[model samples]
Target: MIKIISMKEEHIPQIYEIEKSCFTIPWSKDAFEKELKENPLAYYIVAESKGNILGYAGMWKIADEGHITNIAVHPDFQHQGVGTLLMQGIIEEAQRNHFIGLTLEVRESNIKAQNLYKKFGFVNEGIRKGYYQDTGENAVIMWKYFKE
Candidate 1:
């Protein structure tokens, strides 16, 4: 059974691997460490089964909003509901903290990810030109509002 739990220091390596595999401009292990240890606003969670981590998600609580920073599932675990589980976990955390909304920036060309965000009640709000450094791809800004 896959379990969603708070991310810990020990999980950074595995999460880094997933980040590397999933993104062209992946964050470094040190960055993850800093976020876990120094960033008071950051919240992260991992999906694990038995002893292995399958995916991870992270967000930053800013004011009354939760900004999703990253969400990635291991290639082998893709399409097995890991992403959905991660999204649920993150959204739950936001709601628990009384966040008024959740926001994320996704690559405009990543239709699959955009669709997933839409399924979770996130709607396209705007666009960011050249938001991705690796490919100079535009980003689709999405938001999920919990209240008026």
Candidate 2:
């Protein structure tokens, strides 16, 4: 019984745990705090089941475009449709806001995530060399445009 809902302050600890579990360079709790409290452009959502958060995703809406900041699901929750639910929530949010498109960057080595984005209509558009300082990994830029 997973449900996608607006991310709130109480979800930070769980979201941070998922971030640490999923990424080599995880964002700090303070960063998430600022984004949730101080950033007007940022919109985030969490997937919860039986009172426990299983995943989270966030984006920053700039003008007519939405830029995905991050998306992660607990390893225990991976492959269980948590990611799909989170992505669906983000996409719906973008469309409701009348965004012309949505974009995100994935680690070049992360084929799974790339495929997930592709499944949601995001197409690889370019690359950012050494985008990840932790491993010097390149990033694959992807975009999904909405019909006008």
Candidate 3:
């Protein structure tokens, strides 16, 4: 059984590994630590089974909008509902905090992610030119509106 919960300090190392494996430009450990410490409006959640970290997500809520900062599942755990569960967890958190909307940027080439977001009612808002420097790829910004 996969369980998702708020990320803790001890899960940083494993979360770091998953982040690195998932992205071409992974966030630093210090960055995650700083986010945990200084960002009260931010949230990080992790998925685990038995004793392993399979995936995680981070988001920041500013006023009525929630911006997803990061989300990834280990390569070994992909397609087993980890990503879906992680996304659901984030959505619930945003609703709990009374956010009016949620948004994120997905790599233009990542159709799977785009489809997943679409399934949850996110629509394309615009494009961010060269949002990801490592690959010089454009990002497709997506948004979801919720009841206040």
Candidate 4:
């Protein structure tokens, strides 16, 4: 049973666990804390099972653009619709705010994530060289335009 909810302070430890498990380079607890605390445009959602977080997604709204900051699912929960739920939530939030579109950067090697975004109508827009600091891998920029 998966539940999606607004990311709360109490969920940070579980979120951190999923983050580290899902990504080669995970964001630190301090990063999440700061986003939750200081960033008014920060919107985050978490997928939980029984009380443990299984996945999470976040976005930063700047003017009319919604920039996805992160999205991940626990390895154990992969292909179980956690990523879809997290993304649906993000899309709903973006629509609610009247954003023109949503955009994100995924590692070029992350085919699964790229495919997932494509399923939601996002198209590749460009690339950023050396976007991943730890790996020096390029990032694929994808965007989904939402027309009201």
Candidate 5:
């Protein structure tokens, strides 16, 4: 059974591998370490089964909002509900922290990811031109507001 749990220092190497496999401009291991060890407002979780990490998600709690920084599932775990589980984990974490809303930016061309966000009640609010530095791709800003 895959379990969603809080990210730890030991999980960095595996999570970094997933990041590299999933994104063109992946974050370095040091960045993950800083987020886990130094960033007070950052929260991250991973999907693990049998000691192997299948996916991970992270966010930053800014004021009353939760800004999703990254969410990725390993290639072998893709389409197996890992992403959905990670999303649920992150949203639950946000709600537990009393966040008023959650926001994330999806690559404009990634309709699959956009649809996944939409399923979780995130709606397109605006666009950010050249949001992705790697490919100069536009981003579709999305937000999910919780009932007060």
Candidate 6:
């Protein structure tokens, strides 16, 4: 049984492990630490099962919008609804905080992630040219609106 819980400092190590497995340019432990310790606008959630982290997601709640920072599921747990659970956690947090909308950027080549976001009502808003430093890939900006 997987449960989505608030991401505490203790969860960073496992979240970092998932980040490394999921991204070409993974965030450093220090970054996660800072977000958990000092970033006032950031909020995160983790999916855990039997004391093991299966995935994690985070966002920055700025004004009336929630900017999704990252979402990742351990490769072994992908396609098993872990990502969806992480997303649900983020969305619930956003709604609870009265966010008017949510936004994220995804690699243009990552169709699976795009599809997942689409399932949650995120629509293509625009493109950010050469947004990824690692690969110089354009990012597809997506948004999900909750307010008029």
Top model number, TM-score: 2
| TM-scores for the candidates | 0.97, 0.98, 0.96, 0.97, 0.97, 0.97
What is the C-alpha local distance difference test score of candidate 3?
Answer: 0.91
* lDDT tens per residue, model 3, 35-90: 99898988999999987999999899888889999989899989888989999999
Pairs in steric clash, model 1 = none
lDDT (CA) for every model shown?
A: 0.94, 0.94, 0.91, 0.94, 0.94, 0.93
CA shift of 111, model 3, Å? 1.2
lDDT of 6 by residue, 1-148 (tens): 9999988888888888889888999999899999989999999888999989999899999999999999999999999999999999998888998889999999999999999999999999999999999999999999999974
The parts of candidate 3 lying over 4 Å away from their true place are none
Each candidate: RMSD to true structure?
0.9, 0.7, 1.0, 0.9, 0.8, 0.9
Which of candidates 2 and 5 reaches a greater TM-score?
Answer: 2
True-structure lDDT of candidate 4: 0.94
lDDT of 2 at 107: 96
- How many Å off is the CA of 62 in candidate 2? 0.4
Candidate 4 residue lDDT tens string, 1-148: 8889999989999889888888888899999999999999999999988889888999999999999999999898899888999999999999999999999999999999998999999999999999989989999999999988
Off by over 4 Å in 4: none
* Superior candidate under lDDT, 5 versus 6: 5
For candidate 1, the lDDT comes to 0.94
Worst 10 residues of 1 by lDDT: 139-148
lDDT of model 4, residue 15: 86
TM-score of decoy 5: 0.97
* Candidate 1 residue spans exceeding 4 A from truth: none
